[model samples]
Target: MHGKTLTFLLLLISIACLDLLLTHCGRSDHKQKLQKQDTVLLTKHWESPIPHQEIPEGLTSISAASCGTCHAEIYKEWQQSTHAVAFQDPQFQAELKKDNIITCLNCHTPLQNQQEFIVRGFINGDYKTPWKEVNPHFDKSLQLESITCATCHVRDGQVIGALGSDRAPHKTLKDPGFLSEKLCLGCHNVVDEASPQLVCTFETGDEWNANWAKREGKNCISCHMPSTERPLFPGMSKRAGHFHHFPASGIPKFKDREAGRLESMEFTESPVHPGYSPGDLLNYQLKIKNSFAGHNVPTGDPERFFLIRYQWMDASGNILKEEVHRIGEEWQWHPVAKKISDNNLKPKEERVYPFTQLLDRAGTYRFRVEVTKHRMTEENARYNQILGEYPLSIEVYSKQYEIAVE
Candidate 1:
């Protein structure tokens, strides 16, 4: 009788375990279904149409301006970044001289009709003259600010925010780190695999998403769009909890030349008087490497500048001659008070250029190049002082040149 009871009890316990397993499986399926429904709903909303608008005259495209319609403050701040000026940068224009295509505009500059933007030379194309209607240009609107809202937050074709998110915007964080940091990698970690040749030399997002940067706990927005004080606006009662500036790598030479950051420098020599007599031709080479940087070298606004000063001097320490080799030119956003250029060599990159000039007078001469770092703002200028001068560096490159009197 006891044995019979033990068998009956075992059967009852087994049945209970089976019932529990079935319940757990059912809940798992329900959760997955909810997730799928959420994804589908998001897609439907993001794909919803905005009234078609005409492409601005001579302009190839125009984004929906969805974020601009709501978050005017963020839209304005976004305009201040280099991402906004991705296309209009003169350096970018110089690059276009190498490879011109519409594919680049599609990613670099957001527009409604990329073809039109290219045709207008508002992007990369055969733009011989300044664009008449530069709306598609970064200087004109805040719409093209580095991919903006429509690119990522509305993933799976779903709006993710109160403004442009495809779904009914969820104000509260359902996922603990969702709004704080996690969702950033979904887009910022992107790379242009379609044309690896034209790939951005400095892919900060790519670097930040890597295991190294991840281990450091550096989130995307922390470095890309850093926080700055701003007046709180409506519709952002929740988002305002964490300021979203999306600080980027690279910055212009700060206004205070002494405050510039020094990474590295280089030098080279070219035929100064290849076939000419002593008073005929003076030639040499100038190279300054962006050996290092606190962030990416060309950080912040697209118009940042880096330049080098070349001087030819006599033994008496008197200035015999001098020329400036601009690594980069004065950008439009911050026009140079003087003619200045930048090498724009990213970290670990090197550039070489030959300098030639006819010598009017011959003397015991020496060549000297000083690297000056300039920033757009005074409080921010450090490219020169931080990198070159602060410690009174004696490692500068110098060479002696002579114009042999015939």
Candidate 2:
């Protein structure tokens, strides 16, 4: 009886050992499979240790031309955008001098040889003319264009996924990889993570993500890189996928339009100014009002601003005098600043104010009022919105002119 019991115990121990060994082997095999899946295969273009070519020395360089070849429309949009003129923006240049760390340039400029750490700049804000006011060694080509497909779409020389992906790096797209909105977070959502600011100024991406994600599902590119149906490239005749000029959507409406906007303008001339003479002073006033906006004139980002430009022109269409008023900032021409109040108007609420300017030596003065919106560098710091100018314009030209000399 004792011998049988001992034999049973030994056999059970041997079986347990075998099971442990097999389990270890299985784990080893699984690890190897994961490693293989993670390994990235380089393309034919990346034969050398470095992925890209030397990028021959030239004023504009060859790489930009390559991008321009396929993305003509994108390039055209970029040309009109401030990304194309980032380096040349007088304000950007001023601010760039303040920061020595080249970190901002990393996204602003593209890498040449896939050598991750090198920072570059546009050879001086010249999109049309390359390399003339040459700031060489800095990338003159593709870098001038803001964010591109290759910029955010490709990761580590591999096309993992596009911008708005839910799964992180190395996750399978079958499970929903990067999408357009996710791509925007990289640059647009830059934060100091080390500052004690009242409101985080540099967290546009984070703010938008928090606000929009819960309400409805939309990505950054959906609004900014919106698509429109155009004839195929180079006029193929059949309709193909043409991205829209406005690539942003899902923005809250004023009643129902974008960002609760109810702004409009019209021009009308006065009957005539009394006691007017040739080469004498004439006064013209333009009425501009913000009918409806949730917050301030240019809400969300504090840096976004509106300016009223009043131009007085003579009957011959010669601009005689001009005065400008900037909202939320100090301007010499006008002494008023943008007002922030609890009673700020919402959709359907309207406020009218007259923009007035005086012209001397006027002969049938023409009055024009322009509402100019600018996304400047300071605003970019706060809202992470790109630097651009948007204008809502209204003009009134005089039918005939008579200036009386005193």
Worst 10 residues of 2 by lDDT: 125-134
RMSD (Cα, Å) for all candidates, in order, is 21.2, 19.0
lDDT digits (tens) for residues 1-406 of candidate 2: 4674365445435434644765777765754453344322222221112223332322123343454565477556544443344444444444444432233344455444322333221112211111111233444445554344445433343433333334232222221245555554555554431112211133445444444332455444544554555532454443334352332212221122232123422334444453465544444544444332212334343444455676667666688776776644322211322324323222233444354443444344555556554544354434433233222221212233344323
lDDT of 1 by residue, 88-118 (tens): 5444454555444334444454433222332
Global lDDT for candidate 2?
0.40
Q: How many clashes would you count in candidate 2? A: 30
Candidate 1 whole-model C-alpha lDDT, 0 to 1: 0.42
The runs of at least 3 residues in candidate 1 whose Cα sits more than 4 Å from the true structure, single-residue gaps closed, are: 1-66, 90-100, 110-146, 161-214, 228-232, 235-406
Best by lDDT: 1
Ten contiguous residues with the weakest lDDT in model 1 = 42-51
| Candidate 2 ranges with C-alpha deviation above 4 Å | 1-64, 87-90, 110-146, 160-177, 191-220, 230-304, 309-325, 329-351, 354-368, 374-406
Per-structure clash totals for the candidates: 56, 30
